[model samples]
Target: MYGFTIVENLQKIDQDIKRQELKYHQKRVMVSKEFSFDAAHHLHCYEGKCKNLHGHTYKVIFGISGFVDDIGLVIDFGEIKKIWKEQIEIHLDHRYLNDTLPNMNTTAENMVVWIYEKMEESLESDQKDCRVEFVKLYETPTSFAEARREWMTHE
Candidate 1:
């Protein structure tokens, strides 16, 4: 009976250690990437300088959150770029925003939301434990907008 009790306690201790390791590995981490594009846009109803068609060296930062995988990376940098190339870069880079996203105004606020949604769709099929966390858009060097998945809704 003494030997059996000792074995049981050791097994319990081992299980607890494994559980803690799993929990540590499963904790969320965030990774962000930045991209640049040149695009032109004009705000339709704006009463400011944005009303006229103008070009900007736009900057975008994308954030993703998830558990670190066996490779110890939240997500690969190249993978993020590939996703952007497919989901956003190809259409928006060097294109007129009004012509590219005709359904909506090309304000930074609206564009940020659109980027988040597009990235979300592209990441939906990911087999990893990751999701889009946030998107920041810079229409100018200092002027920008941001969106987070928790604050925006999909229809």
Candidate 2:
């Protein structure tokens, strides 16, 4: 009877250790930052003509994904937003997108990639663990563009 009880307690301790390990690896988290800017652009060429200058109140959404750290947070959302505001919105807002971005053609697709690149640079400079997973740029109420880093090849 004494030996059986000792074995049962050892098994329980093993199970508890397994549970803790599972909990540690099972942590997945995502954090996002949102920013907006108003920018004007004209497509250089079009059949029906979006050639005329126009502007949109553009909305940009950035997503960062990773396993939560021991602190149980992927990253501080406020810090991400501040980076976006400084690096993107402050520069692009009330400006011509084509003129503001060097070598960028200012289409929604190009703008999305540009935003992604800027966020990537800023995140790296800040020494942040989270990466710029994806960028979504809303050009209009019904139209948008999305770009992902080459590393985000899964989606």
Candidate 3:
């Protein structure tokens, strides 16, 4: 059987580790965050069930990559949430997609790209060294559309 042992002393910042040692590596890293929103919309000029007015609880995932800062952190997860809430989710959560989004089909494919662009733009505006690596938007539990940096930048 395995045994558990209690700690004898807590590691103090200055006593156990120096401030200069806070950052342990210089390698670039990727961090991701997921968010969900519910919105209503209907596709234009399409002969399908989705053409009818409908709604979906959408899920979006963002993968951002960059070199770590002094603390060995790529980007704070809370910063990602703040960016999503203030810059992206404001136009998405509980709103009419057809009205809020730019003129487009409102399909997962289109939305994923738009979401990726928005995140990229936000990061650029903040002058953050990080870049959006990819974005995945799920229209359904089993159906998702993805936008990758290579495809966006190369094309």
Task: Identify the leading candidate in terms of TM-score.
Answer: 3
Per-model C-alpha lDDT, please? 0.85, 0.76, 0.94
Candidate ordering by TM-score (highest first): 3, 1, 2
Candidate 2 per-residue C-alpha lDDT over 70-94 given as tens digits, one digit per residue, 9 for 90 to 100 = 5456777887878877887877989
Please provide TM-scores, in order, for all candidate models, with all chains considered together. 0.80, 0.74, 0.94
Clashing pairs in 1: none
Error of 2 at 155 (Å): 12
Scored by lDDT, the top model is 3
lDDT for 99 in candidate 2 is: 78
| TM-score for predicted model 1 compared with the true structure | 0.80
Order the candidates by lDDT, highest first — what do you get? Answer: 3, 1, 2
Error of 1 at 148 (Å): 1.1
lDDT computed for candidate 3: 0.94
